[model samples]
Target: MVNIQKLRFFDCNCSVGRVAYPHLSDIPDVEGLLKEMGRAGIEEAMVYHTVARYGHPPAGNALLTEAIKNNPRLHPVWVLLPHHTGEMPHPGRLLPEMEKHHVGAARLYPGANYHNFSLSEWCSGELLGALEEAHIPLIVDMDTVSWEDVYKILDNHKQLPVITATCTYRNNRYIYPLLEKYDNLFVELSRFMGAGTIEDMVERFGSHHLLFGTNMPQYTGTAAVSLLTYSAIDRTAKQAIAGENLGNLLKEAWK
Candidate 1:
């Protein structure tokens, strides 16, 4: 049995993309992040790129890859801008990079980067098919895009495990329906704290569909950790959300 309280945490949502705001720019450095994670009982994390403006997606990806390369406690999630250049990057090349870099997943920010929603023809079946073949889960920012559009995107790729980032109280209405409709839809609990959001999601989707996430830098890691550590869910359920779910998903993919 998994020990919920003692479980390691894997933050599925994080971005070092681009510092668009001064507050974001002043966030803790990697060492500080590790200290915070240790304080919050997080044993490991899967982080993505945030420097969107400097080199677009690839720059952020490179930065994160370098930062986490030596940190066994951290894992890299590669960022891809399918809508950039008005054409998807060659999957053959991109997938190999992810594999070479030991990236565990692929992150997309249609709303954050102003890309066409995943439902767009540009983000075609071929692109998704490649991701599936490569066994990488797709992480998206649901808060930025419309739920209807996200749903349509999921409809086209039902077999893909789609994780969402930056979820908040406002998106619960959309979240509930999507969780109910698609077994592959999973949400990272980051911005959706206090507000009874975790309780509500637990009550509906149970712990299986939820994964622990600290928006980190954007939202205080302490607050996000508190939400899960203080939740009403049982220890087993908490364990699943905090780390087991993500671990299980990754193991399945790697196998």
Candidate 2:
């Protein structure tokens, strides 16, 4: 059996608040989430509000920011919208909120939540420009984002770091090329349960290009943890994928 008693993991993608679907099991709130993290051995995470993805960004972001206050282990990821409506904050006023909430990252979920805007340059160019300037990490899930749009965004904003989430083995056809083209791109590795593919990815791209994440509550963190724990990669590579890469990326955002 594989053991990871000493591994320190930092989960790069996670969410709180209730999802719109009632058929799914309930996800934990702040207190409960901490308990789940403790059990899973995930030392820290970059968490977004579940409502932020599907509902009002400010409301959910406020709730999440306040909930994790003074708790360094739970980092907040604010959801950003085009601000075409008066509901969300514009890029002009993001820095203060980020400072207040200690947020170093943001995400876009237009399609996931039924929002009717594009992440195209003409739509959110200013917001993307500001985030790129600040060096904040932007996470987009494969379920909601199109790779064609991702390519356009990456092509325009070469310096912005983007972390693609919830990818599976089938995504490699385009994903590998994106990785090669963009040094600033990082992949979240929990949903991509490709067995030995972890070793293959580490060999093709350095271990620093991947970050540990679990779609926790939706899936068991243990399953993903076990995969990494048993991989043929060396301890140094495993540790980097587990947490070090994420830690370094977070530091860069604040820098």
Candidate 3:
């Protein structure tokens, strides 16, 4: 009954600006992003903060949260720094706040922000535990870490479903085994290389585990949208990648 082909998108890996590279840190504003999404057929997007690029995770998350609060089409995803500040925000405190404010997911940028790969005892146990208990999906920037490191983190927390992002064309091969190995791992097709790459990933991994994403300002939304529009896959699979997969995931998380 869900019209997968006509379904809009919920981009899982977008960021707002930070102070680091003022010019380069320019992510599109919510209105601008919504307009772009409309043109590209995206209905909503789950975005996070880019302030980590400037070493200010809390501020960045605050900006993102406020932006999404004002836009019905935008959903906020808080960014947490378990390694940078040497203090993890209390998940018991934070998860309720996110729920109170309508935030849907938590994102980690380990490679971009230089966080330790191991999710062992030293990591932010409280935060991770709360997310698992709350059943909120965690989005990780796979572009920031190696496949080996990603696997290790996934192994530590098998219950949490992680949506991986900032994926480039070259990492397609590395992503396959992980997709096959973990039922909870999903890949966002953001910076994916070409049409061929998208088709191959969907063919091998099926459409259920691939979500549509556009890094936006860093890359054109149109280009990322076109990659899927032009792919040879069935309309159902394309629909799943575009938004259905992310929607189903959110429905389960919010349930």
Top TM-score prediction, candidate number: 2
> Candidates' TM-scores?
0.86, 0.93, 0.85
Which RMSD does model 1 reach against the true structure?
A: 3.4
The number of clashing residue pairs in model 3 is 0
Whole-model lDDT, model 2: 0.82
Q: Write the per-residue lDDT of candidate 2 for residues 51-98, one digit (tens) a residue.
A: 777887788888888777888888999988886686767777866678
- For candidate 3, the TM-score is 0.85
lDDT-superior candidate, 2 or 3? 2
lDDT of 3 by residue, 1-255 (tens): 785445466777666553345435354577666666777776677877666434556777777777667677778887776633545446666677778877788876556345544455465555666677677888877656667766765666677787778877778677888887888788888777754877777777788988889876555577778778878998888888888888888877755
Q: Which candidate is the best by lDDT?
A: 2
Model 1 agreement with the true structure over 1-255: per-residue lDDT tens digits: 885436567887655433556564465357766776777777888887566423467767778877777889888887676634644457777777677888888776666445444546455556676776766788877656667766866787787788877777677778888888898888888876647777777787777888888876566677777788778878888889988888877875644
The C-alpha local distance difference test score for the whole of candidate 3 amounts to 0.72
Q: For residue 250, what is the lDDT in candidate 2?
A: 78
